[model samples]
Target: MNRELVLAPPLAPPRWYRLRRQLRDAVLALPRYAALLLFGAFTVFPFWWATAAALSSDGAGIWIFPAAFLPNDPGLRWFGRVFYEMPFWRYFGNSLLISTATTLLVLLLTIPCAYALSRMAFRGRNALFVLLLVTLMVPAEVAIVPNFITCAQLGLLDSYVAVVLPNVAGAFGVFLMRQAFQDTPAEVLDAARVDGAGEFGVMCRVAVPMARPMIATLAVFTFVAAWNDYLWPAVVLKERLKMPLAVGIFNDLTGPFAVSTNLVMAAIVLSVIPVVGAFALTQRFFLSGGGLVRR
Candidate 1:
């Protein structure tokens, strides 16, 4: 005779048990999700308000109490006034030129500088890096007076060079690019060298392609900064024609008469469109791992 043992049936979760688990998770995550949504709404509300103001009529008085979320009578009349009443197109073109030139020059200078700092073993490398880092801590306000004096001495006052030259050797761009270049795989660089590729060849064929994301990031940042710059351009450019859009807008808006809030809003909306477009076009690189060159 053999003794046999029978196994009990496996216990399955009750229907209410799954529902309870989901409820517990939802309760735990509710605060965090609510906070995130609140923050997003807070950040986005200003842009919505600005867009509404831009589309509103002159003497709309939307900025007053009991502000309307959407304009009652929306029109593009303010934008038309901005364009036709002022030299808006000329200022826009000047800003575009200065920003583009500054971005290009900064990229050209910073990329090689970052590559050298990141990849090469050389004397004073650590010291140089430390110095560069220190400069970032220094405020631009401290240097503005000296910069202006130098611009005057060089007779570069009122010139585009005065605005663009100061930004070409940006500390932040160099730092960002250095981090990007350092992330590149060493083996790939070594392979290029083993194949008799020179430093320049390796940089062109391997480093640049991998660093596309970082470069695009840098370009966007530099372009935005240069585009929105007002203080330096105002100090350097005495002539109305020589001034960038930022300073030009200030000059036009704050004349003897009261400034039209709607028109100013319209100008701001117009100014931001190009930067938004640029960011949208280049933003994919930030996620695509296009900047990181691997072996």
Candidate 2:
């Protein structure tokens, strides 16, 4: 009787069972996946359109009227005009210098300040953070008058110093650094201390490495903000030669008898390349979180 017993191989779930599970997963994912795709397209389409427009010929009527999604005759003619007809290179260089300097100085100041705020517990620390948050809520226009007056008093008007100095110690950078530093493990710091490392040594060796992602993120933010800044430079810098690319580009767009749309688009393309290149280069740091000031 025991030898007579037989078994059938386990059959795959009834086709409907497998189908039902797949259907459930698809249903659950549909809205989220759809939303993500839609948002991505929304954000990216304008840049694609801009690139398309930049490649089109001047006075060609491709971008006018109803606006062409694809150019009729794509050429580098506008790009040529950007370089040959305008001081495009000079403005680009000035923007690069200002943005680079601002980013470097902000990093130097914010890293230490954030470490102090995060690691060193003291009176008014929370208050200081709260004050910064409050300041963030207030529009930049609120402070522009006083800032302008101060710059004038310092005899910094129409100078690079006027543009770069005001932005050196940025509230946003300090806030970002502080938040990032707070996430560093206390045990790690204690171990460093046990190894006879001083505060600065521990910060360089331990804290900085852990906060690299946040730092890269901060750098991207600062670089974009500085590069796109127009009002401050326009207000402070009266001379055309001293103006940053943003102001210069705006002047090119609005100051002429009839704006060359192609040249303006070319300038736009040129202004964007640096930021895009920078993001592409430093974006690796964002993923690796590698540049911690380690021992």
Candidate 3:
């Protein structure tokens, strides 16, 4: 039949309805927000304690329960003591060089290897990848004895080379990069191949660009690992000047005559700055890169 058409403006929800919806959402989100806040506070407590201790005029009040959190008399004296009492600049330089070298070497080695694993068809490729995965299950500490002996045999002990060589090729990096490479679009890869691009060219021009976030994440991980490394460097590096910041602080500052909690805490604080700064700089890529593969 015959029908009449009528048009009407959309009506907004009542204010009470909107307020109720918002209140419901807030109530629903309360537990998640609470959990996050609790974990954040837990994570921050140690850094706060260390900073507080470093800023304290003396170490006596640092051990007390409530007093521990607040500096007795905040000042820069402990930080000053850290510089005067230790070869901090030398240690800083050594850590920086080693960490940078490690990051570069890891990227150089893992990218090609991961690309091959992800894109190239080869016999026993699955088996090889499985073996790499298996290596991830092994703790790094398990290899220290063999690494030390090999370093000694090669006469590379007490050097940055020895410190950096062991960590250059990591299964975790290869795995991470391989996963990222695997997510690259096959159509884009074929397009590259059709454009007179070989495997190396496709990887360099196409895959690498898309995987930049993952690469940045890997670089940050490698740098932080190399920077914070203590055990291996302590074992291999004998010379006072050769030590990285972590080893140098522990070895030089904890001696009987030099022992002071305030100075040690100050040194620890100084050592942590670069790591915090690096992560802060790359945090966006790091957090987003894990599951994201750019098209």
lDDT winner among the candidates? 3
Ordered from best to worst lDDT, the candidate numbers read 3, 1, 2
Model 1, poorest ten-residue lDDT window?
Answer: 286-295
Per-model lDDT: 0.86, 0.83, 0.91
The per-residue C-alpha lDDT of model 1 at residue 125 equals 97
Q: Which candidate do you rate higher for lDDT, 1 or 2?
A: 1
Model 3 C-alpha lDDT per residue in residues 229-274, reported as the tens digit of each score: 9999999999999899999888887785265888878888899999
Question: What lDDT score is found at residue 101 in candidate 3?
Answer: 96
The local distance difference test score of model 2 is 0.83
Residue clash pairs of candidate 3: none
lDDT string, candidate 2, 153-232, tens digits: 99999999999988887678888899889989999999999999999999999999888878887888898899999888
lDDT by residue for model 1 over 177-220, one digit each (tens)?
99988989999999999999999889889998888878888999
Clashing residue pairs for model 1: 210-291
Estimate the Cα RMSD of every predicted model relative to the unseen true structure.
Answer: 4.2, 4.6, 2.1
The TM-score obtained by model 2 is 0.86
